[model samples]
Target: MEKITNFSVRIVQKYLPSAFVLAVILTAIIFVLGITIADQGPMTMAGYWGDGFSKLFKFGMQMVLVLLTGYVLAMTPIIKNALNALAKQANTPKQALAITIVVSFICYYLNWGFGMVAGAILARAMGSSVKVHFPLLVAAAYGGELVRGPSSSIPLIIATPGHFMEDAIGIVPVSQTLYSSWNIALTIGLLVLLVAFFLLQKQPKDIIVLEEKEEIIETKVFEGKMCFSDWIEHSRIPTLFLGLLAASYIINKIISDTFSLNLNTMILIFLALGLLLHKNSASYLNAAELAVKAARGIIVQFPLYAGIAGMMTNAGLVTIFSNAIISVATIKTFPLLTFLCAGIVNFFIPSGGGQWAIQGPIMMEAAYNLGADPALTIMAFTWGDGWTNQIQPFWALPLLSVAGLSARDIMGYLVIWLGISGIAIAGTFIILM
Candidate 1:
């Protein structure tokens, strides 16, 4: 395992392009596939691409806010102190690996974006405090994100009212999917297996030590007289009051809408809570600036993925691909086949909600025809989407940005976990089916 892992790491480090370039490459590949397989004309393909580019504008903003707010929240003194305290529990590299896996699992299991951001931050903190394999640590943190959390995009979107499939599926509740006995068991088993994998992997020498960088310090001193604008920027009162207002709105939403953490609500709560936790507006903005820097990749790359999704959907390629897979599926084999197809489609349309939009209808048609459980089929797609994310650079952008490493540095390690996670997830699908 160690030798193979080393070989894969060297191969990826030598060959993988920058994630942005990879996104471009994916765009080009999808275009060719659209023309050849879907028989799309050049003008039509251009239209699809153009339409696709802007399709994710709203979702892109939500994701960026998730990354930004999560980062700002992590930078607060309280969160930082808690992370540092967690770091102290790890006296050795192996223990540090365990800590990364557990903390990331708990965070992601609570909320996917929180887990992604918090896991990366926790890895950095652990790296600063202990001698550990940095790439493996980051990879392990990402590995914890493979299970679908309740707040995950696709399931939550499906559960919400007026989703694309609302008329077809009639709002399949979380109890039938996210909180299902099958999903709960599978998640627990995945966590346990991943923890064991990290503990048992041979430690590599030549681990990189994280470099310390100077942070923007927040200042409260006014030069002379405090102006109204200066007070708004530097004082706690106005910011705190606004934060309270935001919090009150979120509280009302929870009470009225039930205790669900959908994307919009999660972003709102995180933004408000981040503002509330900071000492003053300056401090919050300073942390926010850092967060923006870390999330630069996400800010730029999401539109490209969105465009890819647009092409996949508008070009009629999603149905072609999904139907090709559905053609071979029996009732007994439908779940696995759909899972495999979803994993393949995820490479092109990387966003969970986006993939569901394109593939959900096709998968539902096949499930209905084959007389399979719609819930199980949906979970299959869920696992596939989460499964390939280990190597997919899209979701890794924010985590990689936070750790200050390129995808090549961690993806090779993640490829190993991808195989492990695939088996566990696939096995569960078989059992449940």
Candidate 2:
């Protein structure tokens, strides 16, 4: 039994790196096809690949800024002192877990990058006393942070076919009518699951051991001590980040107003700010390096998926997939089916926008044919997309790596959390549908 258990663990561990590699290879294949065969000319393929690569690099660099900010904040004596104070107050795992969940949710909604930094900071602070695994805390942070996506926000107005249903059928879909209510239900469900997990888990005594060990060996050392003003200047780029974020929004607004271009302003802003931040020649060069570093994986993989999406569309595989759902879907069960399909696609296409680009139209057409509420269909898509992040570690990779862990290290904990979220989301959709 012991041998078998160890073998299983080893197999799982071995599979992780292979999975990432396979994804990359598949992406390369797609790039080749897009270049060689797709109706889009060689130049178009090159442009698309280049654009994807550029986006990836920009995102990667922004990730670096986030990492730097987190490191600076974590090294602060004030933050350290506060953690020490908080450590004294945490009497139980429940308190620590509650704090973790709340902070995770808040930061995640504010922005995923900032949310990740917040999670690490909070984990380090609370890890002083809670004695829980750092990865587990980080996983919990990811669980909370991924709940809100494009489907839940105003973007859903354009992405989902809810409005069309109201016009055609003269009835509002459950998602359109009860979006907030469903969201609240899902949020509460996730919170309860997190609290329950923390309460039931064994507390780590290692935290106390680690702290004591550090205290004994450490000489009092202060490095880069700075006043509030200096600290503000150092970490002040969040303001710039925000400004870039706003500028992207304004640019999109201008584009929308003039050319009627509908682009993800948030992503555009993140890319632009990442490019503009380093004004100097050296820093500009560094930005290019950073972009390459950050975006290489994404750049490689996106074209492959884009190829897959193209193939799926061209060969009518998407129709077959949608038809499978349509065959079983009734008004009552349509929402559940929609959720399941969205969840499955999310495994391949992790980006909310990307998934929507592929699945949105098909779902809309199905909803219309089935006499189901389009809004409900959209809600189902959102629920599936957001709920699976607890298990789908792709998005959480950057966050986990930053926290000195890997997806495999935290997969078990996140799976448990994802199970909870999945159940909650599925149940809520059922009830509302």
Q: Which prediction has the highest TM-score against the true structure?
A: 1
Model 2: runs farther than 4 Å from truth?
1-15, 22-94, 128-130, 149-179, 203-304
**Clash pairs, model 1 backbone:** 52-307
Per-model TM values vs. the true structure? 0.95, 0.64
Query: lDDT tens digits, residues 270-356, model 2?
Result: 445543443222333333443344334444555545545554444344566767887888888988998888887676556555566
> What's model 1's TM-score?
0.95
lDDT of 1: 0.83
Per-residue lDDT of model 1, residues 17-95, tens digit only: 9989999999998888889988898788878988888887887787778778877887778877887799999999899
lDDT of 1 at 321: 80
